[model samples]
Target: MSKPKDYTLLVIDDELQVRRFTEVSLSPHGYEVHSAESGREGIELGTKLNPDAIILDLGLPDMDGLDVLSSLKSWYQGPIIVLSVRDDEDSIVAALDSGAHDYIRKPFHLGELLARLRLALRNNQANQTSPVYTSGNLSVDLSSRRVTVGEREIKLTVTEFELLKVLIRHRGKVLTHNQILTEVWGPKSVEHIQYLRVYVGHLRQKLEADINKPRLILTEPGVGYRLQNLDLLKEGMTASEAALIAEKVD
Candidate 1:
């Protein structure tokens, strides 16, 4: 296992206390923490450091957090988690749509923040390293275009598979409806959110053990959907090993 020091985290927040708290809390866990007070400075530091992950606040001094997120997403491919006091659903949806990997309301627990950070980093690495994704009883083999739920092979339509590919690629992260539509159907189809819903329902019926209560593909209320990241199966095996086993199984 790689140590946290192998990762560098950038925190973009105007609040001095938030910066200090994040630095003090994460530094001991082997992470290299850096802070920027304004959106411009954050963008500059982000470019200079090219950190593995970023903890961004929606309220920046020079510009709106959404604008900063837009700028970063244009160049940065790493995970960016929005940490802010904005609790409104609109703000959350906007952030997710703007390319945030996750959203955490203010007055958050350090443990939860750490867990989110870990997940974001893990998912990012997994996307780069593996063509297969597994969670719970579900396994998707992107290389072969195969999906299985336990012992049963599940067949999916081309559109359904494309949608599932998007979700699996960003497993554990919230994907806005617009993002999903744009990726799956195209930018012109972004407004067709109902199309996304129907396909998701089809996926649930095929993937979920109980369509009434989905454990894999989860709805993020008014935002979008997230693939639950249950990760590797069994003890002591890495995700790669599990993927290999899943691909080999009948």
Candidate 2:
């Protein structure tokens, strides 16, 4: 009849307000929270604390978030959710490709943030034994952590890769916006559905033959999305994206 114990988390953000707010926010959830003001300090603390997960701000006072991300990837082996206000495609792609487990845009809800954090922890543990994930034309070799589209390698940002993997793992099921957000983003953020729209837009743009009539990334209107069967592609000529890709054919 006792309350469940809280997990440990390391939060790395240069902004004092953000750091303090996050620490207080997570404290009630039974999480043993640690704070760092710099990427360097974060990495060192991450090694020492061995926390369940890490929340890292991309823009740091001492170093770039991406640079710190690279450093963290070099040593740490846990869930890392990249925090940033930058919503551009290039920045999101760069962070995910570098090894961030997930990403969070700033000005978010505390409850959603906690959800995202916990989901990251759960996924990190799940990936330890078996890493390969499959859905439609996409197959992610988790052990090798590689993603391929019909035998052709498709580069995905870390967050993209995670999103694809989760969607694949739960194919055919109707994952609500919040469900996808929680699963892909983390336990900390189950309600930031806008983030889902942006990331899903990116995934379809990258993976579908045609982004307009997305065959691979199927939308559920007001709900979440899904991966269509691979056969759907060969049977259809809808390649809005193929034309988009063709632009680079030269």
Candidate 3:
């Protein structure tokens, strides 16, 4: 089996200690780690190295980290995980809304950072290659427009399926109310958060065994919603069985 370090990683933080610590830690794990201390330098290096993944800091010397993120995301197709001290909901939502794959607060655990990076990479790969998404007992065949829960098929209205499709395309990633509404409804409908909520509720009713405590369609509190990508629970489990396990864990 190939080791995890087969990929390249870029660490963009103004703190020399942070860059060094990340390099020392991830280099031992097989990753080719590179560092940049400023937003402009990070953008330049990111454009040049085209690393498989990025660890970005929100506080940069020359420019805001979010701006750098936007610049990199304009062309970079790989995952970008925001690693910063800003743990507030607004900052987190902004980074994710700007196309970040994941967010990690500063003073973070290295183990948790590694786990999030692995998931981001896995999800990125899966998104590119598969038209079918299976998590737990729920299955969505994007190419076929088919959805199933456990052994039984579930029916969805046109609008509801459109909403669900948006969620599936960005599975495991938070979709802001504006993002979801704009995609499923339209740019003009971005303010129609209520519409988005209703459709999401409709989806949960059909997809979740217990709508009161949903496992699949998750609320990201003040941000938006994320479709749970329970990849680990997907092995031979029925929809009902998956729900039961999820309920227990919840």
Candidate 4:
């Protein structure tokens, strides 16, 4: 029942016009807006204020937007929307892949921006309730961005963590190559199935007792992959064998 204006927003942009535009457009609508013209200042402000959300511009005077995003993500846990003139797929994917919740091309429509902000805020709030997910020995804390296996922490790249998160969220359900790709790497990278395979391989290596015979993640045999249900995996068949059985059923 809360409106976006009830929340605080930080805008990291160098262009005075963009900053003013954002302020003028959203201020009357109930948003508590703050602005910074450089990445360094933005990072400092973000760290200090801990706003409900951030709107970041890719082009900045002191540092690249990606750098700022990476730095902020190292500590900040909030919805970050990338607002940039770079509409190229590479830039967009890079931003989203870096940890941005959404990407908006510059010259953006106010309505669309508002809509995306609302959706991101809603998702953020929903995620705040359930931060930790567990499956037997493996545990992932979404809020802390930590993964562990029986008290030992597992190191994972941002991409790998994102991929694992998607799989774990849909445990016991098969997710096709495209579904995983789109969810983790953005829609532009959906055709890059090899990316998914490589990251999955990385996740297996880090989490599995033996990578060759994985006990947790299962390959769908020319289809996709699924995170094994610990209960079912212990009952009778391992996930790998279950996957083989599924292939047979299909």
TM-scores, all models, native as reference? 0.87, 0.54, 0.86, 0.56
Off by over 4 Å in 2: 1-5, 129-250
lDDT-best of 2 and 4: 4
Candidate 1 — which residues are off by over 4 angstroms?
A: 1-4, 232-250
- Candidate 3 on 166-250: residue-level lDDT in tens? 9888876667887888888889997788788888899989999899988788887777887777774353335555554344224
Tens-digit lDDT track of model 4 for 70-169: 9999999888989999987677667766777666677877765665566456556645566686667888998799999998999888888888889765
Global Cα lDDT for candidate 2: 0.70
- Clash-forming residue pairs, model 4: 5-30
Least well predicted 10-residue stretch by lDDT in candidate 2: 241-250
**Global CA lDDT computed for model 1:** 0.86
In candidate 4, residue 170 scores what lDDT? 57
Q: Assess each prediction's global lDDT (C-alpha) against the native.
A: 0.86, 0.70, 0.83, 0.78
Ranking by TM-score: 1, 3, 4, 2
lDDT of 1 by residue, 10-93 (tens): 999999999999999989776899999999999999999999999999998789999999999999999999999998989998
